[model samples]
Target: MSDSENPVDIFRGFLQVLKSFQILIILTALTGLALLVTNGMIDGDWGRLSGGWANVKIFLSESLPLDWQVIEARSYPVCEQEIEFFCSTAYIGMLETIKIAFVATVFGFIGAILLSSLAARNLSPTWLSILVRIILSALRSLPSLIWAILFVIVVGLGPLAGVLAMTFYTIGYLGKLQYEAIEGMESAPLEASRATGLSHPEIFTNVVIPQTGNHLLSQMMFMFEYNVRHGTVIGIVGAGGIGYFINNYLKLFMYSRVFSLLIIIFVVVVIIDLLSMAIRSFVNDQGDVRRPSWFTVLLPAKNAVEIHHGSAGEEES
Candidate 1:
């Protein structure tokens, strides 16, 4: 049959047309959504865009008579002294930021572990799981920045506010991640554990924890890294961290000091990211149940259970 008269060819052409039409519809929908979300940003005044570009050009121009130059010229004579002060203050502020993130992550992870145990569908009772899921969903609905603002207002201010905000937010975030990890675990091992007449706690302490340990640790490390970055942002609202110094410098137009402090923050965040990567890689390489010695010590029974499971699998193979 001629191609145009062929039924298969006609059907194929129809499908191609339908695919293109579907794509066009999707693109149109996305474009409308973008416009709605941006609230006229995309189609705003051309004059404002021109002015913004002009300001950006002025910022980049070395010959511009900027206020920063005046400040630098005045401080040139005492540049060495200024460096010392910047270093000391920035160091202290960064340390405080790290402390806040660390404390928040530790407390949050602990809370997440507990809550996630009750939230996992396979491990927890239906009512308890549903309740925990609802609580977690509510917590996760708000951004960390919003939580920080509320805590700052309630607790007054300082690292305490930052810590509390990070803690609550992290619990929600980590709990969701961990319970997902638990639910995503291999059903074979869990079923085997259940068939052994083990109690719920025993199954969780053995099969659940061991099977998902790597995922839990990896996610926790990521959360800690995320909290470090978030801690700085929350400090802008007087929650007290390196961001406090950043805000102070920006307000005072101390661009040089601000630049230096930004570098410090960058270095700290990069170091944390690298450390997390290394630890995650190490855990992944060391086998499924591999974990830190301290973790093994804390849950010797879990480790033994994992070993038993491993041997059982080998025997089946």
Candidate 2:
């Protein structure tokens, strides 16, 4: 009859809190099996998949006919001299890739602003948050490559389709991140700004934005970096840029060129990541200098380890 009479009682209570159900597990397994059967991504040739992992024999072997020798061929663009010569000509397409990514980022940033505002748990009521969450989730559910493919058919094959896809895709992604940033924000500056009789828009732009500025910039940079990497791949579906070149080489079975393209992509993505990291670090450090920590105003020491609320003005409640 004492609390220690039955440990099983506590175990049952824990199970009740979890809403433990065998039916959910069974449903998950069933759904997984159905997806495995239907999705071509799961139709992986396990034996060759292991072989492919080692980078061998990806395509079926074939012999070219003697008539192929009659056609002229361009030499591989290599060497410092060739790089200098062709970098301008050859990389015009890559510049187009950069442009595509740039346009996409701008549109994506705008869309993210709107969607994230609505998605903000603090700014939005329960129903609005739920609705926008579902919409953002739907935007994020599809692969951007697939979106590019669909758009290529609708808009014709070019960077426009890729840009559009990246924009739409990033809206969902950045919206989710930015909304979480808004949710996790401290309320002190916000309250102070509101108490001054600032409008809601003014409070958001000045107080909240300054508080989260560093994180927001870092997130935006990360989104741009992510788009660059994905932008490299989407061209395979005829969206535009180097991916299209890669697909062309792939069609011709020019594995050497494809390998070269892969190398280029690797270098570019690494450079992009490094640049983003450096910029984010520098910007964050600088931002901290510009904004005084609203939470640390009453700290006893310069490097205070803890925030203790000594008055009603400090703590929320």
Candidate 3:
């Protein structure tokens, strides 16, 4: 029988096609569901969406000639530093946010590592893992914003509240990520360690940590960036950060100042992302193949991927 006509060959071809299109099919289904839900929420009044552009235009008209004043020293600040910008609200607020995020991320990473070791099924008994998982879940159940509100009430408004809120949320989030990474580690090292009669703590420290170190670092960096972004939000409720100034500008309808601050935040976020990528490259296997650069990151994905492959091919050749 011809290969094309063979039933087994036909079935194999069908399976290959299904496998190739599986992701596309899933995305299409998800998109359709999202559209349906959005339509219902809007009550089919698509016409109401037409005013969005008009409102945007109005906003831009007021926010145009982006305010540079935010970077200048405030009058009360009495610019004592060599640079006036150092005394600006933007610098102070953003610095506070970074401090809060940094403290929280560091503290949270330590806490998560401890809890995740216990939660990892490969490292701990099933009962212990389940219990640890429950504790992590309870911590994660409340969003960071809610945590910020609670802390604000407890601590009476400041960066302290922001720090505590972000730390708690980070612990829960990073704990789940850490345990999953631990679980996904190769079983050979773990089995060898256990066979050698190493204790759970020793096995975890020597084997699991080294094996999953790259992933854990990546997660910690991600959590830090996440906390930085959330720092802005928590500040709105007087948790202390750039969001405090943002809230003030918003209340005063100073859209221009708000827009400027947003641009600053956007710049900082981009810088953080680039730094994260560079740092990860140092430890990731792909670092030897191709290291990332600012220009590569700014380029479109298709072009960046093509450039990466081209470089890799050249290296091999």
- Candidate number of the best lDDT: 3
Give lDDT: candidate 3, residue 14. Answer: 98
Screening candidate 2 with a backbone cut-off below 3 angstroms (N, C-alpha, C), the clashing residue pairs are: none
* Full candidate order by TM-score, most accurate first: 3, 1, 2
Better of 2 and 3 by lDDT: 3
Report the C-alpha lDDT of model 3 over 154-195, residue by residue, as the tens digit: 998999999999899999999999999999999999999999
Residues 46-68, model 1: lDDT tens digits = 56767798877754463234232
Whole-model Cα lDDT per candidate?
Answer: 0.81, 0.73, 0.92
Better of 1 and 2 by TM-score: 1
Specify the poorest-scoring 10-residue window by lDDT in model 3: 286-295
Which portions of model 3 show Cα errors greater than 4 Å? 1-19, 290-317
Q: On residues 143-260, what C-alpha lDDT tens digit does candidate 2 reach at each position? A: 8888898899889989999999999898888889988998899977777777789886786677767778767777887887778778778988889877777677678977665565
Q: List the residue pairs that clash in candidate 1.
A: none
RMSD for each model, in Å, please?
A: 11.7, 11.2, 3.7
Over 4 Å off, model 2: 1-90, 286-317
Candidate 2 TM-score to native: 0.64
